[model samples]
Target: MMTYQKMICDGFELNYCIKGQGQPILVVGSSVYYPRLFSENFSQHFQLIFLDHRGFGKPTRAFKQADYTLDKIVEDIEHARQILKLDDLIIAGHSGHAFMAVAYAKAYPQHVQKMILLNTATTNSQERQQQSLSYFEAYASAKRKHQFQQDIALLEQDLKREPERRFVHMCIRMGAHSFYDYTFNATSTWDGVYPNMEIIDYLWGVAFAEQNLLQQIHHLNMPIFVGLGRYDYLVAPVSLWDAMECTPHVKKVIFEKSGHNPMLEEPEYFDEQLIAWINEG
Candidate 1:
């Protein structure tokens, strides 16, 4: 692993951690909720670059929802590429960031060599919203209310002192949708309140209002690989399976013992799968 480096893009100082060498693989982090999970877990295989999008992480800017959108995210990514002097990059994303990855491939198909999606939803509109609601309902039903409240209490106690604490609480309720697992869950206590305002708005918009990338998946000119966690609370594994089977350009692997945050849950296992996909590419 290497030291964390900072890069300036669009007037914002983006913080990222890089490691290894060879083909550049830029990781689009999941909005604000869990920013550093993927970069820390998968930095060994490729020249991994994990960045904190605007309003999230440690960016020197205030939270702004209008600036949070797929188009803007794509722009930031291109700026990052320019800074890195990367021509053929492999882009990967999880959760909401996945939409940005797929959309970027759609907008600039020639720039990206490959893509990796983890627990992503390519569908737009009511389908995604209703499905997410169902996922949370199922998760809620399976767990005890007291336990859920306990988690919330932990989160509140931990983040209450942070400046952006309210944003974290909002992000947790919105991103996780109060659908928590009984056994494995990361609270604001463990990770603190770090949801990016832009990430939240963009994800909510695309998941509820915006072609998302469902129709655009077929348009990708690069090899696409999907990593799905077997017990993901946010996105069902079957969703990825169906998407892979439906898209001729997609290859998929399932992490049988993992949940929504596979990279965090099983780092070595997740990296192995990513390496296998890159080698296949």
Candidate 2:
């Protein structure tokens, strides 16, 4: 793989790696991992351009507040596109990056040839059923509530007396849960590390903003493909599948045994499916 760096937006410089040689296809990494996570086998086919989203792999100043929104990330993607001088490029992103891809397609429909959204759903769908919202709310809230109780216990026992103590415990617990959920539900084998504080803050800030991106997806005008793992708990697969069915010029595919990270769990098959979709587009 060939690795390089590019200055995309103010306060953010990206570390990206590319492999193979052909039409450019940029792969956006998941929320907590860098692009180095993509399989080498998949990179041998289409040129795979993997990017470390802002505040992830390398050091950079972060947006202090809500400025770390998905819209800002979409702007970074466009900036990267221009830097690469790419046209008719294919865009792919996993998990949260899926929202970024959709936003990119919406902002630069003419520049993108096709888009692949993996393990993600529409966040701002007006027609989205209330049941789905209740499900996600309940799930996230439950997890947070449980963690809150642990925090209380830790504090009461004086195990976490320092101000930073609570932060460290929460971060470690969140990382553990995220990693565990991804491994068991998604992959049989794994290799990677959690992102640092800069990336974590950016993630926390954008989590909700990206969740409400269905309206943007509905407005997208490019040929798009939505792929999901049947058992994905991190994202509302049903909502995404439903949105794909409703959106025009789009197709949906599901990997039954996979979960949040199909590319890692089912790399060979994922590459084949993606290649076929790219050719068809």
Candidate 3:
């Protein structure tokens, strides 16, 4: 059985779920999207701890723009770890959350035995942004030619009217194009978790304006696993390549048949790779 619980960390009520047994692996990301996805297969091999960041899941209060910095997020993770009395943790993060995981491991390296970064982008380079935009444009054009133009039109209109819903709508529309294989249903992969737009707006907007972590990550000396999807145009596989060049102790895995979401696109392969990496030590 899974245990759902909450803890007061630095005056904030952080929510987390714990399951399985054996080595502890703390997954810091959007729990609503990845909770069951990680637990279903990982529980048998490791104790999985899924925690929601501020303004996500069951946070005590809504987030303010000033409180959305990467340092603040890392502090929250550390506080949670101390409160839970966890030691020798293996931390993992995906997409935006990967930034937090990296920062946390850097600040508290003694606590983390290993680190996993999945489909993570370290910088908002113009070339990467253009690549993503181009992929979306091509995808839309192809879908429009297939009689799906009406759906595209409606999505654009929805974004224009309710700009705050951009993240939600973008995820829905892009999921279709982001997957390398069409056999997997994207709908089932969605966990129906509403993203904190405030958090998204501030971090991706102001926080990323003058910040890049490609160089800072070189400080990580622990066994680091970097997983990327070959078709992940949103973040681009080059980000992982760039990271691999900087970190001396690093392992890279590229999912040929997946996109930004390898776990959903190829669950069996993802599970096998993750378990093998964990057991490598």
TM-score-sorted candidate list, best first = 3, 1, 2
C-alpha-based local distance difference test score of model 3: 0.72
- Alpha-carbon lDDT, every model: 0.64, 0.61, 0.72
lDDT of 3 at 1: 65
Better of 1 and 3 by lDDT: 3
Residue-level lDDT of model 3, residues 239-276, one tens digit each, is: 44664664568878889877778877778898899899
Instruction: Per model, state how many residue pairs clash.
Output: 1, 2, 0
Model 2 clash pairs are 123-214, 124-214
Regarding TM-score, does 1 or 3 come out ahead?
3
Alpha-carbon shift of residue 245 in model 1 (angstroms): 0.4
lDDT of 1 at 201: 53
How does model 3 score by TM-score?
0.84
Residue-wise C-alpha lDDT for candidate 1, range 165-188, written one tens digit per residue: 555554453323323244444455
Model 1: per-residue Cα lDDT at residue 214: 58
What's the TM-score of each model vs. the native?
Answer: 0.78, 0.70, 0.84
Give the distance in Å from residue 147's predicted Cα in candidate 2 to where it truly belongs: 16
TM-score winner: 3
